[model samples]
Target: MKSREWTDVGTKLFLATLDGLADAELDAPSLLPGWSRRHVVAHVHHNAEALRRLVSWAETGVENRMYANPEQRAAEIEASAVLPAATLRALVTHSADRLAADFDALPAEVWSHKVITAQGRTVLAVEIPWMRAREVAVHAVDLDAGAGFADLPNDLTAALVADAVAKQNTHGNLPGLAAWLTGRTAEAPSLGRWL
Candidate 1:
């Protein structure tokens, strides 16, 4: 599927999960360590805003950092965690809508413009949608709301696995895992507690 289509699918999965949560569930811990479901929702909202800033940078030829620093990003998420369930739900929905609009409004020519990600890698504005798609798809499961990798499109899962293996190769810490994934090894080697 195209990035936009994947983004839509991810958004639907995320929103459906959010919609089903009770107020108490919002305070419950998510699959991600140390993050409650509220934190997960807040992160998703903040991520949309961050990605929008990158798209804005591309369109205007200005440098817009996704966050001032890791501290600021963490503080924002913590601050947002106090929002009521209804408010948090609104934030998730509205931020996603605004991001989709921003992406759709970008001129075709500007899609090739470069912007820096939070990880400090320069990427084309065209890649932002896919970035958001990955965030929503993975975090939907992280929210512990019943969505899983099986619920995502096959193409998206395949793309994410390929991207993960490529990143692991670049990091040089998963040589044996990479060999196993690529069929170079007959049996998957033991890589204890990698995650």
Candidate 2:
């Protein structure tokens, strides 16, 4: 529950993911339709940068979008995909570090600030690290690194399972919490199915 602890999970997960992948493997498509491993990594990198911006804006008493906008954020991940594998890896590495630094620099109380994301959802600043951690951990599997919800520690996997369940109603036919976390489902449940 500590802010640093959450960030540490993200940092460690990302690093472990990096170790598991090869340059060519990063661009390979996984189970997510039309998305390569690169896409997943880009999403995580951009997400970190976006969180840094969000936290900074919150600290300054300025209400900025958690992401510039949905389209804009998507464009960022696509842009990162243009880089060669090595360059993309470097970008992700640095972005992760910067994100952790940003989180570490926040005043202890600032983690409690509420911010509205581009998705039109409001979440506390302290929750950002958990958000990023899930991204890295789940997508690490998308890259076919042999990591999965089952690979995560029990506590983290339990939390992710809960989140996957809570998101099921709004997001549509997604791999239910148990399916995804337990590897019973191969593809993510279709968001449109529930919608």
Candidate 3:
């Protein structure tokens, strides 16, 4: 599969979900606690921008971190979350387009260049698209616009499930997860919020 195919399918799904929301519905709370649909939309746009910066770092041979810091990311989302629905939609769509174009223009040799994610993991530049795929696919559901994980492409869904589970393991409380997966516990493990 092309590195960005996951991104392509994810973006298509996310845009469709966002399209189903009405202007007034943007103010409604999303499946994500405390975030309205507008906040989800805004975060989607900023995520694209952040990933694009990584692509730029790869393309230009300059170091560009995804965000200055965690607070900058949170601040950007909170500020953009209050914009008019139409404006937020247009901005997100444009950002996605811009990120795709940037990805297409990245040099083949640069695909192997290292970049740091907002999460602070050093990954190959090629992983940038998958990073975006994760955001859009999950946030589409968080929008609470009648979309769900089952609506995503099967392969993407599998990849997301694996990624999310691996993340939980990395966070270092695995006994609960192991017990639940093995059916030794009736209750599923409690996890921190999804990114």
Candidate 4:
């Protein structure tokens, strides 16, 4: 599937999970250590807004950073975590809708424009959807709202595993894992819970 299609699937999956949560469930611990479901929702909402900044930068040729700084980003997430469940739900819904609008409005040529990610890596505007897709898919699991890696689409799971292996390779780790991932070896090596 295309990046936008994957992103749409991720968004639907996330919203579906979000809809099933009770008010009290928002305070329940998530898969991410020390984070509640509320925190996961807040982070996902903020991530959408941040990615919108990148899309805007691509459209306008202006430099728009995703966040003022890492500290500011963390602070915003913490502040958002205190919001009520209804407010958090609205935030997630509205932010995702706004980002979809921004993406759809971009000119074709603007997709080639370069933008810097929060991690400081430069990427083209076209990659933003895939980035958002990954965030939503992974964080939906993190929310622990009955979603799991097994619930994700097969293609997305494969893509994520490939991406993880590639990243580990770049960091000079996870050698031989790629071979196992690609079926070059019948026996996969033990790498416990790296994700």
What is the TM-score ranking, best to worst?
3, 1, 4, 2
What is the Cα-based lDDT of residue 53 in candidate 2?
78
Best by TM-score: 3
Give the alpha carbon lDDT tens digit for every residue of 1-195 in model 3: 354998887898899999987899999999888888898999999999999899989888799999999999999999999888889999999999999999888778999999998888999998999999999989988988888999888888888878877888888758888899899999988788865
TM-score for each of the candidates: 0.91, 0.82, 0.96, 0.90
| For model 2, the run of ten residues with the poorest summed lDDT | 186-195
> Which ranges of candidate 3 are over 4 A from the true structure?
none
Collision pairs in model 4: none
Worst 10 residues of 1 by lDDT: 186-195
What is candidate 1's lDDT per residue for 55-136, written digit by digit as tens?
Answer: 9999999899899999989998999989988898999899999999998888999999999999899998889999999899
What lDDT does the true structure give each of the candidates? 0.89, 0.73, 0.89, 0.88
Error of 1 at 194 (Å): 9.6
Q: Tell me how many clashing residue pairs each candidate has.
A: 0, 5, 0, 0
lDDT of candidate 2 over 2-21, digit per residue (tens): 43564576567766876788
lDDT of 4 by residue, 31-139 (tens): 9878889989999999999999999999998999999899978988999999988999999999999999998888889999999999899999999999999989988
Q: How close is candidate 3 to the true structure, as a TM-score?
A: 0.96
| Candidate 3 Cα RMSD (Å) | 1.2
Q: Against the true structure, what is every candidate's RMSD?
A: 2.6, 4.1, 1.2, 2.8
Task: Give candidate 4's TM-score.
Answer: 0.90
